[model samples]
Target: MYTNWDDLRLFLAVAREETLSGAGKVLRLDPATVGRRMQRLEAALQATLFAKSPQGYSLTDAGAALLSRAETAERAMRSAIAELPDTTDRLTGQIRIGAPDGSANYLLPQVCAAISDDNPDLDIQIVALPRVFNLSRREADMAIAVSAPTAGRLVVQKITEYHLHLAASEAYLAAHPPIQSASDLKHHRLVGYIPDMIFDRELDYLGDLGITRVPLASNSVSVQINWIRQGGGVGVAHDFSIPAMPGVRRILIDQISLTRAFYLIRHTDDQRNPRLSRFAQALSTGLRAEVARLEGLA
Candidate 1:
């Protein structure tokens, strides 16, 4: 009878990772179990496959030759693994992406570049959000969310931390109560995105500040910016977001700095898709860098 495939597979990961612990992470097994499986594979083959080193496990000559064959088998098995991340089977398709207007719209250009770079054939449908897109229902193929954990058991990757500050146009700040401290903002005319537009659960954390949400609500970030610039009100804005805009003025950077996490939520069901995986990685990477750029960290 042929040797079991699982042991060989575990051995391959150990050889590639160069540590039993690292291999266990790839295989989702305990380190001892990985060691036991490697032993079993070696015993079955009656060959010493690895020379364990202080730095890591290195494959002996026999293991090195076997590694190439194992990799081939692994790729073949991946092709047969029921689902793979790459759009290997299907060439062209659309990916529906739902995101918030504030940062998402600003960073869309950069994200488009990454997507175009990697998945030129895959079309991206940008959905504006006031409500969370239900990924379990496939409302969007993926989402850039400021969302909380949901009951559906979805996979959410935190991409970056978006920090908020109380800002106004120079004209607006000049006309409002002295915002030198948190207490002084009590009477400022604050422009804000419609409370409904904030889809993140942590947004409610803003309530802890006791700073009232300005009644002059607009659903669009541009409209809110225009209102603030025209001396309509002081508003909560991302510090990074406003540095590039010509007219917005920060009032209380220290007193108003509140940070929230931005997440990219993907379905656990589609986690194995090569195209989606690549797309997600590129999106996350671009977003992390773009946010740093926006914050002047770049």
Candidate 2:
């Protein structure tokens, strides 16, 4: 049996991260070193632990069998460390947050970076996507969602109310017709979310634009913003993001601006965990402050 606690720690990191590079980032070691350690662990156990693939590493049956026990060991180690005096301030664990494209691309990098900078021992994974994250399945430790979840054993916190507006690049507007009213949107190249791929109803910005379809569409808000930047078309953009975009300018602010909210979600059980609660509070504070800055309140 492997008796080295350090190697077991590395193994547990790999199991949670599923990639050498990811594990290395958390463990503060080189990816090559992580791989070598994993090899050593596998050799000692005489079993294939991870199935390597282009996507990432997946646990073999042997690895899966050992997972629960390894996790139990990890918990025990944490508990023992916590019992030591003067260790209450130290935090160590993994936290994965899922978010939609808008906040994920533009907002979460800043928020999560600050969190990581403060807590060097914490592993943070930001799963930025357009779909709902299943909290029950443990897909993400927490989520920043466009809407408040009404179902499941999830606790919700209102992060902020953000506004969006119709926006276009200077080059795009120069080549296209003038926008006098909401109805004039039909004459120009409109960019928006793909209807069928629309994951959340709140993301259906085109419906508010009085258009059934757009000339160019994508499921990614970052993609839509990029298309608009390249003069692909006019699209809706978060007001905060528009200020940072060099070429993009807001249009129809009086007639087309809309407000949406972001909610912080976690499983109800997580509310009892101090680490989760503290991190959630930090996230909420950061998001609200950013939103206020975006709204010119800060």
Candidate 3:
């Protein structure tokens, strides 16, 4: 049976995006056009590819089986396109990065900005969520994660080790009892991640400190940091982020220090694509230097 590569390409987009509107945006086509194309593709194959619902399009069993084959074909096409002499040396495509809000807010803005400055045509999107990203679904082209995922066809690169320390606004410390040690944290209002919402054990900052109470808690790292900036409470803060918030000071750095590493994750198949390889190299190098520079100020 002969199948159009364009139809297969559209199938991959709809599968990855899980919505005709989203696929439309990516392909620069209207939703109605995308829907019609999907219908035509399904009809030509004489098989239902997606189960439609208000939530969006979900792949049926046959669609799941076809996804791997479609991805293989996609990678082959990318490799062929990369070999063409007409290809530009500069990266010029949209690449979405999924990351925890802390890095997304404090780290990526500068790192990605420098990259974009060098390659003006490159479009970078950062999806800041406080949970793990599903790369298999193509939610992002790459992701920065606190921990390496053990079970996925992924390429994981350790970016750098970053530090965090107990911190509070200078005003809060002046108004509250002096914190001489970890024990003193019990006497103060603590800000941290919501107990039940802690996505990763690495994010359980307060629990590691053996503190049970969090009077001010949020699922977002930015929210927790903002609360600390406003004198809401003492909480663990990223060392790199401290220089940006003037009044926030790290407390008991000698006694209360936490270290974590960031890992750059990409789909295994994408390792063959030269564009992504160059971008990944630039991102990793920039993140290491940026982390060192910022932590020096902290």
Q: TM-score winner among the candidates?
A: 3
Best-to-worst lDDT order? 3, 2, 1
Report the CA-based lDDT of candidate 1 relative to the real structure: 0.72
Provide the lDDT at 42 for model 3: 82
In terms of lDDT, the best-performing candidate is: 3
- lDDT tens digits, residue span 36-67, model 2: 99899899999999999998888999998877
Which model is ahead, 1 or 2, in terms of TM-score?
2
**Tens digits of per-residue lDDT for model 3, 55-84:** 999999989988888888877886786555
Segments of candidate 3 deviating more than 4 angstroms: 22-29, 82-89
lDDT of each: 0.72, 0.84, 0.91
Off by over 4 Å in 1: 1-92, 193-199
Q: What tens-digit string does per-residue lDDT give for candidate 1 at 159-278? A: 988777777777666665567787776667667756666555565433556744667777666677677767787776766677656777776676667888789998776666676777
Model 3, position 83: C-alpha lDDT score: 59
